[model samples]
Target chain A: MTNKRVYNFSAGPSQLPLEVLETARDQMLNYEGSGMSVMEMSHRSSTYQKIFDDTKATLKRLMNIPDNYKILFLHGGATQQFGAVALNLMDKGRADYVVTGNFSKKAAQEAAKFGDVHIAYDGKDNNYTHIPTQDELDIRDDIDYVHICQNNTIYGTEWNYVPDTKGAPLVADMSSDILSRPVDVSRYGVIYAGAQKNMGIAGLGVVIIREDLIKPHKENIQVLAEYDTMADKDSMYNTPPAYAIYVLGLVLKWVEKQGGLEEMEKRNIKKAALLQDYLDQSDFYIYETEKGSRSRMNVAFKTPNKDLDAKFVKESIEAGMTNLKGHRAVGGIRASIYNAMPYEGVEYLLQFMKKFEEENR
Target chain B: MTNKRVYNFSAGPSQLPLEVLETARDQMLNYEGSGMSVMEMSHRSSTYQKIFDDTKATLKRLMNIPDNYKILFLHGGATQQFGAVALNLMDKGRADYVVTGNFSKKAAQEAAKFGDVHIAYDGKDNNYTHIPTQDELDIRDDIDYVHICQNNTIYGTEWNYVPDTKGAPLVADMSSDILSRPVDVSRYGVIYAGAQKNMGIAGLGVVIIREDLIKPHKENIQVLAEYDTMADKDSMYNTPPAYAIYVLGLVLKWVEKQGGLEEMEKRNIKKAALLQDYLDQSDFYIYETEKGSRSRMNVAFKTPNKDLDAKFVKESIEAGMTNLKGHRAVGGIRASIYNAMPYEGVEYLLQFMKKFEEENR
Candidate 1:
């Protein structure tokens, strides 16, 4: 059979670079003369250790992460971190959470089980269509840490500026937007992202944390979830997700070769503009997210009606695109043009959208 | 270059069948004409959902899992389940733990944090060389469950008979020997394994639990760690390890085509016999595990001295073999020939051992 690669626009576990996939396929049988697939190598072997170390080093360099911060490749994704962040750091028994969208709301509820969780800001008042401005946040200095979801994938909203947490350490879940743009790693106590998005594959969670917050000896938490132990062991306390991390390493190298985060930010801005500019000009489509808080990763929009939106999604798949249907919570169309989604993919999507709009009208 | 596959025997995350690797490579670019890598597909997409369903169904059939059992794909490996098993099943405030080897000892310690843990039996007395018989276990009928390591990867031992836990339910960590032989799924309440061993790849944990044991609404535990939530959601409560599960499905299919577990057991017995028989007749090597308790997956042995053991490991690499080094806790050699290791691999290993024994002595 012919290798027919198409344009995939799923939100998380979304598209990856075709080049990266090809490289992975090439090395599937024998990885760098190791005489075995990366899937079969022992985590403790020197051959595999190099892959693990290089993956972390590339991420640290790409993020401009300081020596004080550790890059941890963990399992259970960012959803697991919702509890881990609180279990290890909520020593003061209270923390402020900004409920920007679906994931942030889940984080606040999960943290509530571990400590006294205070909602510093709730975007639900506006149907989670926008991120709250810094002045609108009610964060307290007494709290252990202030939590935020940097990018809301489902709601198609992104935090434009970091909130001042009144001296409290900041924790951000960048599951959808990490690696798409540059960020000040020093500003946050912890930043975690699941690998299924712009990073690479699923089953791995990348955590960048300030060294001081990692308490390996933290009581009541499992050893695997403890940031200190995972960091101390260099994230190999036991058998790690070897193949996922290897694929993640390959993706990071691909990003680095594309000229670091600055180039990524420039490209991302252009990709988002391609869709947003079209949405702005079109009268038939309605982009609900406020302009300032719109995400460069996920573009959630709707046609004139539900029936037409369904038809658009159905037709788009036949036209060589998939995963354009929006989240169920808010029915519409969402084109998650992540880093791997080439500019040409967006151009093709725009052409389809325009043709669908003209014909349906 | 040539795809030179070598003999790898490093316990967990060991070698996989070359056929599975070839199939994975063929489909790495576009999985079965879905036009996207499995890593890129959304968990909610019907195309990806079918992969997930087929994988779970294949595992259920291979294990002959009863209808009352729910199979879950989770993160954090079996180590994560060390805490998860206790958090979900320690409802009676305690459980009986049988400490057989490294993993079970760690599991017992982790379970101590959540509930009352009683050491039903400790094999450490024999330096973890053997599994205790039924009458030797001081298990309690009132406990929530009786925990055991079905196969000890580190110490090269296997439970020859399932210990009768009176009326208490049984929980086993089958990380090292899960699919190497037929198992009576109905006899155990819960059996969990890390995929890096007998299953496939790393970063994915397979939990086969009796439906009654799954407590999704179990208070005080994190949502992701709750077995009921994972089972109820059919292991898609969140973004799972997609690529790992896909590879696992391929491995399961390969095993099914190899005439299922009965055939696997037959081959495993022959392979283990080849090594054990050689060790039985050899005077230069020492196999410490009791005869009936020997693991077919991992064969741990030592030379007459530590120096020769090191030399044997160093020379084996040059002889087209790798990962023969033993666990650091016990400094010797451990040849982990899991289900994926062919009979010829074992034959080659025996050939090397004979040559090494003649030269070293």
Candidate 2:
């Protein structure tokens, strides 16, 4: 933790482990003495092939993915998957979506283009204040799949436990909280994440789906937009985001070194608890979401007054804590403590918050 | 040229300037004195916003793209555009495709799934030996657009001049040849290139489309698949590939410092002429394409036997010249001299080929 440097709270496209960034920088020009940048190497070359294989294997190991699942490294963020999911799976049948936040609602709307989309649960009525309770969910028996967002970055709410779909295929957009905890891969039919918040960079998305879920549609779909074609080609039908994949490999290795997902979950909880405990004790600041549903990664909070919230954000930036401002849609302050954020960063923030409270109060 | 360290001849996802790599490496830990990697900075941050703005501006200057043309930095490679173009423009009627190489054929095949697709001209019957002659073109005035691959990386062929489309909009997949030379920007409706070849890395695709071409679609389309939404949002409706865009800016700067597109065209011509002249003069090896239609970037040639082609590829790898093997469809040796390849690399390859020919003969 002593080696930990700056505290970055920017929400997606956030911090990567220092060690991973250092290793990638060293290998940028010459990857493993191949005398070519990973970007310059052919995807089929033994060097790049090994990197690709090892990266996928590492991700599988970290997540405890089943042998029946195929891990795909694809281009276009999770937004593209909204369309891909519709094209591949909808089949003009009914699909249910639990809209906990902005992303899930967007996904539901996109998926609606292909089939009958039912909003089984929506947190928008409550300003996305809490995760949908299991009893609140309205699963349709005729539905093809159930889609949900596991974590909401904008509102700082996360599902505390996976919903039991009673044998319905579960598909989750775990973009913001994927590697931060342990997940049972066998329980879900599909898990997709944009590699920005807890994974690697902004451009690539990681999709881990059951092989059986990608059956070809009866209605002809565009070949490139079909999941089966992409899965069959191992996501190499077209040129992939090679550099992002390479960096993601480094990040997976870093996660393994940090004692894998269980350890990551423990450390993340400790860090979140440190800040949440401080916020709970202080009447000077208010946690934005309900206590039970607060996100471990992104902590959204506000001061008693709007002017003070602005001042806190401004003074925090001046204090070397940048990007602490919240989403424009819900403005206050959001401190995103992603995988790379050390415990000290959170401690520093809590201390500053306490001092600022005393000074302003 | 003496100051140049080594010449790189990779086809796509090829070499980047050493200075750019060095600067990026130095800034991998921190960008613009910010205490975070560019990979870690949020897309919404002013720090990253500047980087994004500068990248778009540099690309515009390098291409002399008109203000009326909206430049979009997208993901999923040029392959995505095969579907995206169909989704955007194929509503009125069919599209005319000129199949000059593998990429154009794939584009046509993908578009066929969406709407009526007609192959106006195909060079496959001639083993892609030459670009189509003006008289051979099947121009259809009623077509929505004309699609052509400006340069065929696999077959080592390039269109020397834009096809005369009397009324229909001209669209080009310039994945292999963009920014290698100047073009009449006003003549084309859209010019898209995958960044791997001449722009930057594999993750980003640069699309320069006329603004009018992005008019709202009358039919239902996935929001993510809509060009108008992407253009209206400045390519940020979803998270983009940030590091790839950063590298593109560096390449754009390098192009500008080298006297822009006019100077680059002269350099490219000289490099192509040096190697093609050697291939023409030598009786021991045969050039794969016709004399007039040879590619200025990828130079494919063949010996009389398959074993010799394998030997050349193996020997060249040992000599620090890599990826010289041609596409498996074309069983021969190909030397891809993209913009990053210094003139001396071509000289080295010629020298090696001459020696190999003498020994084998």
Candidate 3:
């Protein structure tokens, strides 16, 4: 095994806390003297039940979730929730979606399959570089819920202000930026995230929803996709992603020890500012995202030309950083500095960028 | 951290090989000099892609899967596949289900939500103690597909012979007995199993389907649940359960080194026979499953009385064998000796059983 740990910056399924990995390794053979790895234990077993309960509890504590909200540890990632959200909450057979970037566009498309999906705001014309202002959103009052992706991993744009849905339930896909900042859990009817980015690892989806919103859907949706079924069974409808939830619990504990979401937001802001400041001044680089819409989690930028961008990605990997390549949909560079990404990693990237700019010019 | 590892007898999310766990622990911090844990890598990167490709390749090699079939590593367990099976394959809006045990019953119930599910054979009256004979299964000629749970973890029954479905395609949920022995992939239209049992861990479902059967469904189903969508995307439809797939690859490699399916069948038969033989001779305990229907994976048995059964379950844990308690649906003792369960583990359980029998008697 290599002693080196590179700064990984590919959107979701990205970097996890080193402490969590260490703890997981230490208990790989046996968990808490239980004689089986977390992976090997039955989800129904008391030992694994504790891990499941503690993970849900810690996330609730960190987010200050209301008593009316229930946390579900599910199998599929946020992509699965794109359909589940619409299937479960489209009680009126209609919903509104704010299409800010790639993921939101996909979510709207999936939701359209289940019911009448109205695109309240479309950012396609602006190349997904801008999050729509509340005034620009054409949310329908009769819709069941208003859907929005809180942060766009591909476009590097995040909704700076929560849209007023005029009393309608707000469902947000916070896959890339959930735990990186403090969230008003009461504001949204549901908030779901994939556990590969700000949490711990892949294989798990964390969904927090207001208890009242989790009623039986009118359609014949899959039982596993029904929020009420999961809530009623306490997310043990079937065997969960046991090991991923255990690791997520470890990561949550680490976040708690590091003073929780407020502290995470502080660090994330600083890290983003360091890179944003450099990109703003660099003559050879271009940060396309609108100033007000820039995301603190995923910082997307690129060199003046495609060849230089390719060279930058290659040289960055050689300089002990990898996965800085932008998403295939939008080719350039994207440095995803999630909660687990150290401030030093972004500083290192900035230093490399400075060197590259000087050499390229 | 404890140095001692106990024998875990969980049905699914069951025991994994000790060697696989060691390899995982050794490379927890750095996976093959990639400078990141497998959990931290991007699913799109070359490093992570290699892991994904290698895993699919190893499983295909071990199973001797045909070129006419495609393997998909998906989220959610076999529970999700229950609905996906009908939603994707119920082109005629009708299907036949063989309800042999608890899981098959659940699968049928889920499928009913999507289509007209006909129970061709049900062993409920037999207390799930027998698998239906081929002559007993009344598969309809007009049905789109016939579904069956090949091995029942809760009931400890297995279908020893595949039923002919006339011209209709066959779909088998091999969640419990997959990889325990050789499987003729061409016999079934689809064979899907949750990775927690004989494979590796929870959070992943391995779907093996004939290319011809993966056609577009008539109904509006979630894209993630569509077999054709997954087959088209090469199972990278969205971020997959990355770490679980990696561990599954390691387990598949271990099975390969142990001489593939023939050797696995030999070891599994030997282990199952040892336990079955002991139960057969013991007057105090009863193995309820019909001899011809007994599974070589999960061996379910009980004492003459409920109190004695509780005592047996309690004493087994004290004897360093855990998860001996049966499913809540059927309260007794269940020792799930999947492929990773060593013969010595069964030996230890037998030793404990013999002592418990003597004391109770």
Which prediction has the highest DockQ against the true structure?
Answer: 3
Model 3 chain B worst lDDT window (10 residues): B1-10
Q: Sorted on DockQ, highest at the top, how do the candidates line up?
A: 3, 1, 2
Name the lDDT value of residue B282 in candidate 1: 91
**Per-prediction TM-score to the true structure, in the order listed:** 0.99, 0.97, 0.99
B86-119 per-residue lDDT for model 1 (tens digits):
9999878889999989999999999998989999
Candidate 3 TM-score on chain B: 0.98
- Candidate 3 regions off by >4 Å? none
Runs of candidate 1 with Cα error greater than 4 angstroms are: A1-3, B1-3
Give the alpha carbon lDDT tens digit for every residue of A3-108 in model 3: 6999888787888889999999999989998988988988888889999889889999999999999999998989999999988888789999999998899999
- lDDT scores for all predictions? 0.91, 0.86, 0.91
Interface RMSD, every prediction, one decimal place: 2.0, 4.7, 1.8
Poorest lDDT segment (10 consecutive residues) of candidate 1 chain B? B214-223
